[model samples]
Target: MTTSTAPLPDSFDPDTRRVPPLGGFNATMLGIELRRTLRNRRTIIFTLVFPIALFLAFGGQEEWNTTVGRGNVAAYVMVSMAFYGAALTAASAGAMVAVERAQGWSRQLRLTPLSPTAYILTKALLALTLGALAIGVVNIAGVAQGRPSMDVGTWIASAVLTLICTLVFAALGVFVGYLVPSENAMQILGPGLALFAFLGNVFIPITQGSLMWHIASFTPMFGVAEISRSVLTGDLPWYAVLNAVAWLGIFVAGAAWRMSRDTARV
Candidate 1:
């Protein structure tokens, strides 16, 4: 006597398994990422509070009331601080991937239908959300202080530009997160960004056409800083825009390369 065996269904065949289209990139995945980021209390507090503290400390000087352009110098400092906060927040959000990767989340994600492009896009959106929040917090603080003065339209444009340019730092954070160990990623990035801010003239205004000004133009933060201030000064140099676009491209390419290498390791 012989026993009869039945063929399994297609769903039971590993080779024929179907994946959701587009690697399951959707609102649900983005919401999950946002929630996970919001749950990190340390990141939330630092990202939201640190910049406001800096602004209050540095932006309230009596000398800053003197006019620089359409607005007072206080408004310039406010925009600068806003940009810094956005960059810091976006970068921190992007770097959180290091913790996830350390937890073998990347490997788990590989087993799912999540594509690299989808993952990157979701992370970028999360960074933007955090960046905007940081910018808003600092801007509100500026308004509440009633010191930083600018035309309302210029204020709105500068804030928007600052938030948009922060995407460069978001890419930088992702690249660094993938390049280093989780334990050291933020340790290096935190101080490194402060250094970049100093060099990029975010913390100090370099004399235009001076040697230091030329050097600052090449730093990652310079483009964003200058562009964000352009609305107030009415000076939109092509080089500042180029600086931002170039750094953004470089960081994004680096992130994509690092992500591919990381995925390969898994």
Candidate 2:
């Protein structure tokens, strides 16, 4: 009688290892987070209420003007408000994630079949969707008003620009969340992000032809706002687009690494 024993090639080979199914895992987590976030009235107010309120507040201003056609005070304020709204949503996602970590919630998630990569993906999708919806609503509401008119191209370009701006903020939020303790997340993130908005031309003009303007233009916050403003007003800034993407890429990569390391999953 002859007996043969062999190792399991498929099971033991790291080179051929199959990554966990991310799409389903990410989708499921996103769905759950959405439902949970929507149920919280605070989130609804921040995403929809404050931006709309700002639109109303600035819709009547006459001092504002942009190069874009019929781009009056109302349109300028509304667009900038939308940028702020979207940025806040991204920042909040990071803060919320931090809170979850502080409370040991992320640990609970880790114990599930969902891998660390899937968990990170879930946070990213939720943050992006929140940014899009928050900005979209504000923009639509502003347009509904008797704001200035822009060509269809300008409007679409503005939307794309605003999203690009929100991109870095989302990663920034994650970075902040990883660094801050749970109790401090709320206080630290809220004011810090808001200050950035103010400095970035969301609440007011950062002053063209000035040093501050030049500085703000290069900032991630300004990158999104400035590019969108240029595009929305028929100023297609190819250079600005590339620069903004670069800044976003660096910040996001750093933040992702930070989160993974904090979770001990890097």
Candidate 3:
């Protein structure tokens, strides 16, 4: 009472404690995600085995020795199989996001420093890597066993075309993964893509002016198949290019919308 109490001590405000940025791109995280995608033994094995099997069955035949555009029948089939395998691998890698989402990893990541843009870019890169691996494996098999007789230019062009086409499927995979929260992702995508392949003109060349041809011409895979194989034929139709571009846009938009909606819900 005679004197005033000592001045109150300064104290840190617990509420003012700094938190690191909640979201940012990190190369280390991207590397880890890529490694995780590549480490999936089942996917690697499938991408390798299935394409090789298809090549041996359809391409390694005496009957396939006939000419197809500039390359032989065997070369055509080999290119188709290589493209198919790459697409499948990319899609599967992207769809793995479904498992992650179902396990609540996305929600947890929202609490971390990983931004949605970083997350999406990582997934797209992983899908592309897997697709490239698939293409490499299949093409190696083609050169070794299928004995494709295409020039270096054709080989390079076909590889590049197939790589570009895989982007569409990669986007589709992401879209499907975000839409489906269960492990049934692959189950749905596997058969659905197979149908897409069949109708897309990858399996059988659609006869011109026929009903099936008209339907296949409009299908997503048809455009990719046509454009990718055009390297061998040296004929890239405007419609085929349009089709590939259109489907790519649709899938990319769908994936973006779905991802945004999903992250917002968290």
lDDT leader: 1
**lDDT string, candidate 1, 1-266, tens digits:** 24376757868988897778877789988898888888888678757889999999889786889896779988999999989988988888888778878888888988888888888889889989998998899999999998989899999999998889899999999999888866578887899999999988888878989998898899898887889899988888999899999999999999889887785442
Model 2: pairs clashing at backbone N, Cα or C within 3 Å: none
Q: What local lDDT score does residue 28 receive in model 1, on the 0 to 100 scale?
A: 88
Provide the overall lDDT of each model, using Cα atoms, as 2-decimal numbers: 0.87, 0.73, 0.82
For residues 1-266, write the lDDT of model 2, one tens digit per residue: 24365645776878776656652375555888989877868678778888888777866666545444436556667677888888888778756777788778878877766776677677777878888888889878966875655666666767777776786777878877877777576578677767767767777766676988777666666667766677556564665677678878877787778766775431
What digit string (tens of lDDT, one per residue) describes model 3 on residues 20-103?
453566678778987886677878765888877876787867767788788888888888988888888888988887898888
Model 1 spans with C-alpha error above 4 angstroms: 1-5, 10-18, 264-266
Report lDDT (Cα) of residue 60, candidate 2.
67
For each candidate, give its TM-score against the true structure: 0.92, 0.81, 0.87
Judging by TM-score against the true structure, name the best candidate.
Answer: 1
TM-score quality measure for candidate 1: 0.92
Q: What ranges in model 3 sit over 4 Å off?
A: 1-23, 263-266
For all predictions, the C-alpha RMSD in Å is: 2.9, 4.4, 4.6
Candidate 2 lDDT score at position 70: 38
What lDDT is obtained when candidate 1 is compared to the true structure?
Answer: 0.87
Per-residue error (Å), model 3, residue 200: 1.3
